[model samples]
Target: MKVYLRQAAMAAGLLATAGLAGCVSAGSVQDPMSQPATLVPETKTGVVLDQLPPPARKLDVAVYSFPDLTGQNKPGENFAEFSRAVTQGGSAILIDVLTKAGGGRWFDVVERNELQALLQERQIIQNTRTAALGDQAPGLPPLRFAGISLQGGIVGYDSNETTGGLGARYLGIGGGTQYRHDIVTVALRAVSIQTGRVIASVTTTKTLYSVAVSGGAFHFVAVDKLLEIESGFTRNHPPTLAVREAIQLAVHALILEGVQNGSWSFADKKAGDAFIRSLETEGRAVIPVDALEPIAAAKPVNPPS
Candidate 1:
């Protein structure tokens, strides 16, 4: 498998910078549609009402953190830079997609800054160890979140060249070339934050092209010519286009999972899918979920006595 070691490193760096305390604003409130029509279970007859996991007392959607891809070896400058760029771009894409799909108020995509502030106010840094045991853990809080999802990764490409000589070096001449392309795969995962269990995960790989050239003194000329040819292709097929496409695809997959799991409605699923499609087509990145009127908040249910 092709590896995007640098992209992974960049993702980690951006996550650190974004932190976990940003406050996402609810610009407008949207109306909540009626409960989803029931689904019939395969094993039974009558309709099965769509049941939501209990409404979380507090819903916090964490900004995704990419897995460390720095490996034992240090990454070079180009890889590091690419990794960071992709991570930031991917994270922004996920945030915008989720907010639009969840209708903003239904789910809170915690701004990194806001989350960081909350942690600081509570005096809880993720890496800090505490003396409290189990129930007494230092950062323990009763609030419950509906879910958390993370998405991102590195992207890469490669290519090659060859040489051949006429039998007995009859005016000795040699030449050959080949090209291969592939994009680094990115992963997206969704989990039930309260339970600390994954609900869904998806990985996508895109293609990138790379070409190599080789020969003799003539090889220099061939190499220079190849560079010009490749540069033209690269300029037209930039990594940003690939990253953006991957992000949109990943978000759409997540939305489908949310609907199937009862975390989101058909309406929400439709809206979310449409919004992302629009983003892909037009260059418009923002979706105004807050512009709609607020849906009535679900009343809390008491736990069984």
Candidate 2:
């Protein structure tokens, strides 16, 4: 009986290993090392942002800072990591999006994120000219001022909001998959530089996902002989990329809201109106339910009267 059980376990282990090998081999068929560097592909939100209609007049905008307000560290097991959960160069990403908005026709972005560095360079130039010409030196041109200022940051990050896994083993052979879901939220507001009032504000959320698949086996192949094997792979959605997508979506929503509220207008009125109507279904809102009638309190039961 023991001999038969050992044989069964060994056979099961071999079958499990073979099945996992087949799956892994499919992707390994390609020569990954030969792949060349290429431009990063656009996300869905980025594609829509690039396709937006041009505004009647580009708004002069400035982004002084966009920070990660979620102070959470990278998640791990049985260890502490000092690295943050998201990227630190959020302002750069936001500026890049703004510069590319409406095919570079929606915003006239100014350099406010590095204002000190710009001023210093300008001062150096002014000094050099004054010293070289002895009083006939021309003054540097005034920097462009922005009429609209963008303010916002990564407001929330929830790690492992949902997690699940499943697995089965018969005679010491098994395969399983595990998945986890995370969430990131961003808030953006366009403020009128002169009036100090928020022109348009938007909050956007994105879900990040990670999945892992693995197989392993342990069995006795012969008398006093034991064999074991393991194989696995993990796929994790990039947190920074998730942040970027959230920001892009926020920008798209902000533009649409601006149009809806008359804060801005598209160059082609008919096209703009049509586009807005098409996207109306994508907009979301939350409404609190009001009870039609209040429930009456239950009368206290009289004690055995």
Candidate 3:
């Protein structure tokens, strides 16, 4: 009994020491337990979106819907809940992305997804004017027509695409880091309103990564008792940010393909580095390469014999 009591007391003392370490330490100005939200001058999307130049001519575009085709939910280790894996307001996010493409100079979007509500509001205004002044109130201007339609949805989501951990244990005292990766994919297409034909299509993907570094100790304090202690920090990439990045990449692809096919042209030539260098940063493709070689025009492999 005496030996067991001593072991219990020693474990308690070690835990108390750790608790004290977590408290305010020498020269510390703030509580160690609290952390503020990270502040940044600009969002990653804004920084990249701004790289595209304002277009010389904007196209009238309409969007009827952008739905989440991936019906997956947040994966749970214990019990699955009815929560979604991605944001429900995906259509709104897509709309904002369309507006920001080419720095708000690309698409003049018309609100057709809520066509009935818009019409009801317009009708109310028209009737109120008619009731107020008998007959002739120079009618409201006609609603603008769209020349193009943008459509698609979040098509795929994979959970735990990759997961790994590295750790070692000696006498039940150990530390390790574990990481997981998830992926999302989106597909977008533009259609010619007049012809009802698909004009351009593109797809993009974003990866979400999470990592945790943890150290823990477990020990037996008595014949029938055990003690355990653990501390760690985990970081997860925001899923919404992943969605935004995927959509942004799709938009970048659309603009470049359109320009290459002569669907539209940039107004300011000097300010179009962003559009010209799709998936590029600082004047080069974001692809990583160790070496490069310029190639001369290659001879035809073999003329069709």
**By lDDT, who's the top model here?**
2
Candidate 3 wrong stretches, greater than 4 Å = 1-46, 218-227, 270-305
Instruction: Tell me the whole-model lDDT of each prediction, alpha carbons only.
Output: 0.43, 0.80, 0.75
lDDT of 3 by residue, 1-305 (tens): 99999999999999999998778675466756555667423456556665676655777888899888999888887998688888777778788888777568778889988899999999999998999886886578999988888899999989899999999879999999999999999999988877887777898889999999999999999989999999899999888888888887787777655654456655654345333445444453332221111101122121010
**What TM-score would every model get versus the actual structure?**
0.39, 0.80, 0.74
CA error at residue 259 for candidate 1, angstroms: 2.5
Q: Which model, 1 or 2, shows the larger TM-score? A: 2
lDDT of 2 by residue, 202-264 (tens): 999999999999999998989899999999999999988899899988888888666655677
Better of 1 and 2 by lDDT: 2
1 against 3, candidate with superior lDDT: 3
Top-TM-score candidate index = 2
Preferred candidate (TM-score higher): 1 or 3: 3
Pairs that clash in candidate 2? none
